[model samples]
Structures are given as structure tokens and as C-alpha cells.
Target: MEFRQDINGLRALAVLVVVLFHFGLAPVSGGFAGVDVFFVISGYLMTGIVFSRMEQGRFSLPDFWLARGRRILPALLAVCATLLLLGWFRLSPMDYKMLGKHALYSVTFLSNFIYQGESGYFDAASQDKWLLHTWSLSVEWQFYMLYPLWLLGARAVSRHPRAPVWAVWAAFAASLAASAVWTTRAPTQAYFQLAFRAWELLAGALVFLHAPRLQASPGQRSALALAGLAAIVCSCLHFTHDTPWPGMAALLPVGGAALVIAAARHGLWLTGNPVAQALGRWSYSIYLWHWPVWAALAYYGAHRQPAAIAAGIAASVVLGMLSFRLVEQPAARLLNRSGTRPRVALALSAACAAVLLPAGLVYVLHGVEQRLSPKVLAIAKEDGNRFKDRVACEFHPGAADPLPRCVLGDRKDVRLIVWGDSHASAVVTAVAEAVPHGVAYYGYQSCPTATGVHYRGWDNTCVAFNEAVLADMRALPPQAPVLIVNRFASYVFGKDAGNPEPVPGVVMDDEPQLSTRPELEAAYKRRLIGMLCRVRQTGREVFVLESLPEMTVYVPNHLARALLRGERPDDVKVSMADYRARNAVVGAWLQEARTTCGVRLLDPTPYLCADGWCGGSRRLQPLYFDTNHLSERGNRVLLPLFRQAFGGLGARKLAAQPAATGQGG
Candidate 1:
């Protein structure tokens, strides 16, 4: 349980990388490895304490938990309470409501699981989370609850010989293998799951188990410390978000941290280093405090301001110092005092309950709207339904029911069956313009239009639903134009400059295999032709609508701000350059299809952004209602584009007159 100065330096290293990455600095793409470094260090320190005590025959569960509570709770409570109070005035209804749920989860040490169940860690949706970093703390706490007992059980089994070490190693190997498999099967789940993450901790545990030998000589120890430092630095600089994690990729940081800890006792360079020792002292507090500050800026949409961002980072450092002095030190002393720890723990737990109970109730009731704005409530309801709709579609909501969840647009003279997942669902309001009021809209949300491509994530119902759709398409009128569109970015496979290099795992149907731009273009061309051939067999003309442009910021939130400031909605659109660039790539691939297979590529660039200006929302109208999804108002603007692509439809004729104006006010 002795302090390791080198580990603190590692913490400084991890926090520095994470902060740099969050601030949008260049090429620290593998900066997320800081979390992995922390994970290994946590396991090492925590297991060290438990194993040391168990060997002394003095281990107690209550004492162990009290120590953890003292270590983690004070700062966490401070941040969550601060956020809750600030949310009262600063947050929008939806944002505030989301905070309430997070507050509840934070108190219960379940935020990671909650986030995993909702937005996976890499999702853009996760940025709005004020307590996203709390998930890691939760993961650690969950590990602590089970880890000590496992250690003790193994020790007991071997009659206190080498059983515990063997047990730890076995667990490490098993967990590592499990993590490797799960990383590819479900990367998000792999990132958050305790089972998958346990191996990272075990890597540290194994180091602690062999601590005596690792700390043998000063010369050897210095080398180990330097190697550990190098490994962590390399991980921070080279590892990225796309890196197949918790697999073999995580070994560098985990191993590095273990080496640092094992070498610190004998290494004069690390143990005597003033900066390393100082950072090590405040590392725990810094880790707890820094993320909430960064997350708060993200939640309030203030992360773009360089000055505000600098101030926020500085504030986090100040808070960490304060917590170390005023909270962590005092709480640790109190917990160490005989017979006082349990009572203090009970009181803190009670306080946590007091905060969480009301927050949970608020979330359950969906309190952000204050019930005055039914329109906002309606939109929230619709958004909630979209997730359910996605699930249902993936599970095959049936045609045998009284009324199908989705109906194909079969009644229109030119039946335009728009298809894809939620990306298509978002644009259905715009696509609906081509259909008469009574026409059927058949595509279900999350149900991809790909006929032969099998999805592995969902239930077997997806296969059946896909087969049914193909069968229905075979029977459709030949005059119908089937439009295939989905969020192709989700399926795109390549080295992500934004994340670390990905180690491709198991190959599945529809998984992208191309590594280069030329290879990707070729694959895209083949996929398009394959899709086109399938549609032609069904005797339908196919209109492949290339993906639409998206704004740099959250579209609805950004548009809302513009409207609030009285900007012209038509003048707020971003430059069409990026959108055009992406399409140019896709279009190049589609050219072969256009020449040989007669597939028409529809690009809405000119109409979506007329005369070099892509517009924003006005006081009278909203542009994008979601990140990339256009609003009803925004879709109305794009009606001209839709009309041009399909031919013979006007924006005026396509849009129904709004019942009133000044919405999103």
C-alpha cells in the first residue's frame, strides 16, 4: 500500500494526454489510452492493499469499503451536487433532464452501465453527458466490490501458498481472451463491461504479486521505470479510439504501469523526483475532478471558447488541489480512525441517497420540460419512440399485425420506397413529400435496405424481416423508384485519423474490408452495383441518394441559438465543401454504375445549399432538428432539391402550409 511516485507521474501523463485530446489538440489520437493506464494503476494499488492485509490475516470487508468510500465519494459528491445546482438555471429542459438521470446513476456507481445501455462511449451523443467520466469510477468501484473476495477465495483454496497468484493469473488470461472476443463483437460493451475490463486490472495485480522480485536492484529498477514511462508515452501518442481495445492492444499501458509501480521502490530517479512525487499525491483527486469540469463545458456547449476552456482546465487543477487538502486527506484520516469509518460511510451513503432519490423521480417523470411546452414534450416522445422503433424493426415488427409499424409507399403513382436505418427515418418527412397523403410508407427504422447483407447484432427477426422486404420488393410496381440511403459512415472501415489504428477482428457480413481510398472506392462501386442488380431483378428503378451534409455543431442546438439571435435561417448553413468532398469520393465510385448499370446518383448539394450559402434557423423556422436530420422547416427548404432529383415536384406544392409560426421560440 506504499505510495509509488512513478505511478503518479503516469497519472500526470494520462491526464495530460486526455486533457490535450479533449481540447482538440492535434494527433494525440491515441490519447484515450490514458484511461487504460489509470485502469491498470488502479488495479495495482487496490489489489496491493487487499492482498497485503489478507496476508497479515487482518482483512475486513467493512474496512475495505470504508477506505474506498473515503477515497472516491467526497469529490464525486461535490461535482454531482455542483452540476445539479448549476443545471437548475443553466441547462435546457432536455439537457437538464438528462443530467438528472446521470446524477442518479453517479450516486449509485452505475453511470458507466447506464451510458453503455444508451449511447456507447464513442457516440457523439455521449458528449452531452456531464458525468460520462464517472463511468470509469463506477467500473473501478464495481471491480473493488468483487475483486478482494476473489483474491481471498483463491488464497483460501491454496492454503496460503501460491494459490492467489495462480488464481489471479488464470483470471487475467481468461478475462483477456474474453475481452479480445468481445472487443470485436461489441466494442462499446467491451469498453464498459467489468468482465472485459477486469484483465487490465489483473495485469497490474500480477505485477503486485511479483513485487519483491520486480523491486530487486536499483540499476534494474531504473531500467524498468524508464521502460514503463516509454510504454505509457507510446500508448498515449499511438493508441486511438478505433484501436481494438482491452485486447492485446491494451498490453502496452497495462504492462507499463505495472513496471513503473514495481520499479519505484528501488529506483532513486523516480522515487526521489519531486515533480513525480507531488503529482502522485494529487493524482487521485485530479482524476476525480478534471473530467467533470471538461464534461460541464461540453454539456453547456462552451467547449469551443479557448479562454473558457483554459479557465475550466485551470479550475479543475485548483479543485483537485482543494479536494486533496480539504476532502480526501480529512476523509482518509476519519476512515482510518477506529470505529468511526462505518458511521461516516453510512452518513455519506445517506446523503448520496438524498440526492439520488429525487433525481431518479425527476428523470422517471421526465421533468426538464416543466410540462408547459407540449410541443417540446411531443418531440421528446417522438425521439424516445425512434429507439423503440429501431429495436422493433431489428426484431421484425410484423405485417400480420392489425397495422404494421411501417407501411411501404405503394399507393403513389411513382412509388418512392425510401430505405435505410434511422438516417432514412430522419429524412422520411422530406421523402413523404413525394407521396400523396394516403400513400403507404413501408420502410421500418433501423431496417437496412440491403437484401443479402446480414446484421449480427439484432435478433433472428432481422433476417426474416430482410427476407420479407425483398419478397415484397419483388411484387412491387415497376414504376416505383426505390431510394436506398443509410448512415454509411457507421459501416465505413478504414484507419480513423481521429482514433488509433484499428486491428480488424472477425469478418462479418457487410463489414468493410478495404484499407485504402482506392480500395474503398472500388468496394463502394461493387456494393452499389450489387444493390442495383438486386433492385433491377425486382424490376424497379433505383435512385441512390448520396448522404446529406452535416453541420460542425449539433444542428438543432446550433440552429436554435441562431434563431434566438434573430439570424436569417437561410444564411446559417455551413460551407458545402466537406459535404461535396465526401460525395465526390462516393460519386467517383458511382460513376461506373451510372455508365454501365443505369443507376442514377442524386446529389442534393445545390438545393441544400443554394448560391454558396447553406442556411440556419430563423425565428420563424428551425433548420436541422437533430445532429444531421433536417427539421420539418429544414426539409421544406430541401424540397426543391428532392423535386429536382425525382423531377416534376415543387417545394411549394410539396410542403403543407404551417398551422402557425414562431416555433422553437
Candidate 2:
């Protein structure tokens, strides 16, 4: 198969977009699509080479395997080993364990599946993951593993002459269409689905099978190449996270790449360009090595400026050339010459398994708890068992157990009942301390203690759970000082069901308008009034902890970066006034309830926001566990405010209190 310099330049374009986007460059929100473009190009080139050889009776599985081993494994192994060693020295035990697990998955080419199974990409845990980029490599490798067999079959079907190409092309088209639909309905699957991505490669393969004449004169070829380059550039600028991805939206880059590759550049203007060709030559190695280096730099907070990122790109290219010359080219040549590719591969595979097996065994033997100090482990237990688990129980079929199941306070002379959803869990430690003598808590995830409004698309099982929590609250034994606290955004944004799929920026209609402020506020007010009235009817003192102001900045992530740079994370806190302004409607609504609905508002804005700032902190003090949830220490700091409100309602005093301790994470 003849090499195309234009395709290598296309790879440079793809990697450029992804790198810029990762560095917080605004214009390239959709830069992640570069991976998709590579997939198509890879499919095309690999298929073209394999199928062409098979047609000439020159196909050899051993040779093919040797080629792939030389191309992929060495650079990848270098990166993984370096990252693992670095993690062992500097990362926390939890992070180190996670890195080990990530290594295990990466070595096996299954990281994509593992991550998809664990959580959606939007989750907090995914934010700090260093090997998250490997998921795409896994997807590609999985394809490499399967695509060869399909090519052999295509060769077998060549008795019908054109039938094989047509069949393959048709399958690719069908898969592409199915992937487009699935991308919207189940994007997580769409992101990792091998079948959906096959069409991109197939499009490339079709170009290879036909090798149709360009028919364009030199000038026209140059014009087409320039146009293709323009399309690629525009796509990087215009795409964003909200954009429907790898679906119809992916056509711009994929098609542009196809145009550049197939145009075969008879024009001296493009084909003769030395820099483009050089970039093209090392493009494969550049792609293989760049991300991991950027990942390490980003992890360590080394590269952020445009100049620095550009330097990283230059360094990547330099390293790529060296690697292509020394490691990749030599290893491939040696393996092919010696005919020991499989044996070498088996040995490498064994080494990986040997390293990974012990890591897994250690992980299991210690359990996940070995990562943290005893106090942190205790806090984590409170996070999971007491709140996350039990609160999930409130909305089903019966009342939650009236015992303060997960609260961290002393278990004696129960006085108050904390009621609502997982927002209550954020302050579980505080609640435990505030009520002491164990407050009877009633809460559930996604189930607001409200009636008349039913949420759709939630699990059928949750219908009973919702009814149960409401019933339990109704039966609460006239406990005064019943506190109703919840993260208000859920009610406003219709969070009872689940997060809505991110609507891409290119949508033609008014879906974004559907999630606007008025609709959310109206829903919030309705739920609040219903809950407030019901609690007051029981002659219980109802205190509504209006939702705490959420920090708009992704504080912990920012802090991690700052910490790596030897700066205090607290140097970056934004003002709480900003938060108040954003939630003025909710605040005003709370004020109205205080005046008209006889609901006492326990606004703790003062405790959280000093000098009108309501943001994250890093003063060796925990603030948020993630975006919206409070950390255990953050909750501990607020216990005094909670206690004052509960104490005012004649709440029972603490008895047999457990000593609360704090530990370094």
C-alpha cells in the first residue's frame, strides 16, 4: 500500500484539536472528535494494506501481527511503565491503587469497557483519571483484533468479484446509521461502541477497494486539499461538548480526511509541501506518544500556556521521530526478521500479567480501605452506608427506619428528624452532631418529600420507594424541629428522573430553553410549599435549609492543578455574592415562604460565605467531595450552625458521643 503524506498531515490536525481542547482552549470544544477521524483513517489504511495483499496471495497473519506489534506496543509500554512508577511514588494510596487498576485494563486493552461500566463520562471520578485517554486506544486495538478476520472473509467472498466490497460497504453504511441513532439515545454506549465506529473505517476502506481515479488536474487537487484542510480547521473551531458527537456531526472531519487521502495530491502545492510530508511521516509515532506525555504534564500541572503546549507538541514530534527510528522501527524490523514476534508478544504479555496479578491481589487483600487513614475511612463509611444507602430507601414503599442509621453523632436521647433527599447526606456529619442523641432521619435519593407531581423515566421500582418515604414522614412521631434539606437543583432541573442528555450546541429547536430558570423555579416552589405545609401540620417545627450555594468553579480540580504548581488552592476562591446573584430567585422564594407559609428558614449563608464569598476552600479544610456535595470536614465546620437551630427547638442533648477525628487524605 502506498503511503499518503496528506493523511499524516490530517493526523497532525486531529491531535492538534484534541491537545488544544484539553488545554482549555475555548474554540475547540469538539476537538475530541480527532480520535474519530483517526479511527476512520486507521481503518482505511490497515484494511487497504491487508486486503490488497490477500488479493495477491501475499497475506501472512504472522507478518501482519508483527507489523502491528511493532507499531503499537513499545511506545505504549514505555508510557504505562513511567506513569505506574510515578504514581507509586507520588500518588495517594487510593490514587495509586486506581492507577494500578487502570494499568491492568490498559495492558489488556479493556479500559474503555471498564470505564463505561463504572460511570458515565460526566461523573466526578473521571475528572482526575490519567489513563482516561487510553479508552480510545482500547477501542482501536479491539478493532484491530477483529478486523483482520473480516478481511479474510472478504477475500473468500471475492469469487463474486465486486460482491465483497459492496457487502462490506453496505454493512459499514448500516452500522454508521445505527450508531447515529444510538449516539443520542445511549451516548455512553455510542462513545465506546465498536460497531458504530466501524463505518468511519469502512468509508476509508471503500476508498481503498475502488482506488477510483481522482480525475482532477493538479490545480483542482490542490483546491480540494485546501478545502479539506479548511473543513478540518472549521470543525475544530465550531464543535463543543454539547454538540451531538461522532454521529452526523462527525462527517466534517471524517469526510474531509477522506477527501485529502483520496485526492492523491497530484498538485505540487500540497503533495510537494516538505513540512506536511515530514509531519505525515512521523504522524503515527507522534500520535502514539503525544497524549501520554501531555497527560503526564497535565497531571503534574506542567504545561498550560499556549507557548508551553506548543513546546509540548514540538517535543512530542521530536520524541516521535527518535522513537520511530530507534524503538518502533528497530523492534519491528527485528521481530519480522527473527520471526519471533509472537514469542516476544507472549513474553511481554506475561510480564504485564505478573505485575498486575500481585497488584490485584494486594488490592483485594487490603480491601479499598488501605488507601486511607482510619478517620478518612470512617468518614467514607458515613458517606456511603449512612447517607448514600439509606437515603436511597426513603422514596420507595415504607417509612425509613426512624433510627439515625448513618448519622455520625452519639446514639442517645433522640430529639430531631432530618428529612429530605441526598442533600441531607452532604451534611450527615453535621446532622449527627447537631441533633446528638441521634435524630430520626428520613431521606432518599431523587425522591423529594412531595405529593401530586410524579417523575417519569425513573426506575419502576422507585415508585414504591417514593411512596414509602412520604408515608414514613407522615408517621413520624411528632418530632419537633423537623429539618427539610435538599440540593434544590434536582427539583428545579427535574433531577428526580436523571440528568438529561447534553443537548449539542447545533440543535435547531428550543431544548435548551426547556431547562431555563423559570421552569425550574416554579417546580422548586411547588415542592417546597407542599413539604412545608405537611410538616407544619404535624405541629413539628419545620426548618428549611435553603440549598447551599454551589461553587461555579470546579474547585477541587482547580486546586489539584494549583497544588501541583506549588500554590495554595484557596488563592482562587470566588465570591459568594456571585452565587447569591445566580440563585436570587430561590432566595427570594425562600423569603416569601418565611413570610407566608410559616416555615422557618435556617439560611447558613453567613457561616459558609464570609465577606459575601460563597466558594470552595483548600485551607487544609474540606469543602466539597465533588461539584455539589460537602466534604466531611466541611460538614463538621457547619455543625455549630445546625446545632443552634436544632437546640432552639428543644432538641435532646448529646450522650455517649464518639470522639470525632480528622486525618490527612
Number of the predicted model whose lDDT against the real structure is largest: 1
Tell me the tens digit of each residue's lDDT in model 1 across 243-327.
8886788888888877887787444554447765666677677767777687777755677888878888778778877888988
The TM-scores of all predictions, comma-separated, are 0.79, 0.78
Q: How does each model score on lDDT?
A: 0.64, 0.62
Question: Which window of 10 residues has the lowest lDDT sum in candidate 1?
Answer: 656-665
- Scored against the true structure, residue 546 in model 1 reaches a CA lDDT of 70
Q: What TM-score would you give candidate 1 relative to the actual structure?
A: 0.79
Candidate 1 accuracy as lDDT? 0.64
Look at candidate 2 and tell me the lDDT of residue 63. 70
lDDT agreement of model 2 with the native: 0.62
lDDT of 2 by residue, 141-256 (tens): 87777777776676576777665677678778887898899888667777776777778777788767764755877777777777876777777888887776678888887877
